[model samples]
Target: MTQEKFEHIYQRAEERKGGETQLENLIYQPLSNDDLRCITDDRWLAGFTEKVFQCGISWNVVRKKWPNFEEVFFGFKIDSLMMLSDEMWEKKAQDPRIIRHLTKVMTIPANAMMIRSARQQHDSFSEMVAEWPSESITELWDYLKKHGKRLGGNTGAYALRQMGKDTFILSSDVESYLRQTGIIDSGRTTKRAQLAANKAFNQWQQESGRSLSEISQIIAYSCGDNRVL
Candidate 1:
């Protein structure tokens, strides 16, 4: 099915958000490839872990304790984390400086390894992320879901977005918009649904000359009960 032009969507978003300036202010632009390349693997692991911990929990709670998390996780240094034993990870889980969720705590080591593996194959984990083609972003998402622990569905997408990857998140509003538009007729996380969303976003990107990040936010702002001031 043919989707509505991105111009119409952007106009509705501008109207909902009070005007063009307000909507533009609300949209965050993704970093360029060079900027993305400079981000270290440790920071990438940290970003991923933050989103993993924030999943299904109050982001405020995670935000407040984030420094302590950095401290307890040894700044998320990939090599140091890789050297840690299971016993060390267990101690980390029990540490009062951060949340005591063992499952989430364990993602640190697993994701660290994922980054390390990427580093071995490419110049660095950041380079791999930077060089990944936007045309097949879902494939990168699939790689993370396959190779990293607890990074399936929106978790990996959120992490990638946080680390400046130009990928659209399948947020609730975006998913609803897709479903309403007949963009996908299956489960939101299914491969078919992701590819469909990707194609629509590509079309919108071509039409608007906006990054996926901006388009995703615009699509979100166009629908839903987002408050305007």
Candidate 2:
């Protein structure tokens, strides 16, 4: 596949934005404990939980209420959140300050425990992330899908890319661009489709030398979104 087709679309996006664009500007900055003055567990928790809550909901709502979410989850400190009793989460489901999807709310603790477990073995969750294989990033996605709550499919991938992990997110637009460009079959988010997409990206990275983050953003930009919905 020609990278130029994707680049042409992104170039149009650049021109629409008054003739200048930066790939990093269009993507979320990756986070680290040292960079944000936060612990690795907390950092992972934040990205994980945010992706969970944003699923099937307007992302704008999640963005607006995230501060309250941070406060309620004790800045997403793993031990602090683990101490929250079931009754506490029940109360949070009724809290007005945040979206109260009970299942999603409960995932915070499950996810916290996941990071804590990783910390136990790796010294810090960020270290685990750092050591994760970038060349086979889909393996990281598979691990999250198996081990973490609400982390299946795009949610896990979304969290990784949002935290600046060297990964790709198969968001709707990204998938569409892939299909239209003759990279993968169209219809349903299936295992075969995921594997094919991963293979295509692996080849593209080899050919173009772009990070999966930038490549994924380029795919999204190829669909011509100049602004948020």
Candidate 3:
């Protein structure tokens, strides 16, 4: 891309600070306690709950079929998912309302089991996740790799962080924030973006003597959209 185009994209991103993007506001934002309750409600779980089953699918597709998925999956209740037999799986496998990938469909029940097991070991799911170690980046990564069996990888770790399960310095959005801030010149390769973002963030931390929260607000203000970058 031309320098002019890059600058334009950077500026657009900066303009988005405080303003909400569809992804940031509607989709990727962490769920509230009330939101979780609504999702897990008995009636909601009865027919509309398989939304989480689409973990590896593109978010766009998941969002599109979200209602249908709820209709088909009985609202994602652990019991509803647990009740799925091979016949039900086969039936839903052909359903157009959800991503029809068999392996992902199958993993829902397995994931439910894991969630239940975590609850059994701890008093609640949140408590269990809280017990997960978060002292170091390496430990955080390791914990994600081990327990996030359903979707745990770097991307999964990032998602978990967004969901408040873990705390880490790296996230895809943060990488975008760094690029928009002109902190590093590297373009979109994952490794390059990660390295650039991390270096920039560390530098910003030292130079401004600001907390991550404050820096994040600044970054968010500075780089709101990719159009400006």
Cα error, candidate 2, residue 189 (Å): 4.0
Candidate 2 yields a Cα-based lDDT of 0.75
Candidate 2 lDDT, 1-229, residue by residue in tens: 6534445655665654445445446755444435533436787899999999999999999999999999877898887778778998899878889998899998888888777787668867777777776677777787788778999868998887777677888877887777777777754356677777778787777766777777777667656454433
Tens digits of lDDT, candidate 1, 64-182: 99999999888999878888889989998999989899999998998888888886789998899999988789999999999999999999999999888999999999999999999
Alpha-carbon runs more than 4 Å astray in model 3: 1-57, 131-141, 161-229
Candidates' C-alpha lDDT:
0.92, 0.75, 0.49
Give the C-alpha miss distance for residue 157 in model 1, angstroms: 0.5
TM-scores for all predictions: 0.97, 0.81, 0.54
Backbone clash count for every predicted candidate, in the order shown = 0, 0, 24
Sorted by lDDT (best first), the order is: 1, 2, 3
Winning model by TM-score = 1
For model 3, the local distance difference test gives 0.49
Give candidate 2 misplaced runs (Cα > 4 Å). 1-39, 186-188, 224-229
Angstrom error at residue 161, model 2: 1.7
- Report the error of model 1 at residue 158, Å: 0.6
Q: TM-score for model 1?
A: 0.97
Clashing residue pairs, candidate 2? none
What are the per-residue Cα lDDT tens digits for candidate 3 across 1-229?
Answer: 2122333433444455434453134222333444433332233222212334444567677777777766776666777677778898888878976667776666556555555666566665555444553323335444434554444435444444445442334445555655555754665434454454445544555565543333444444444343322
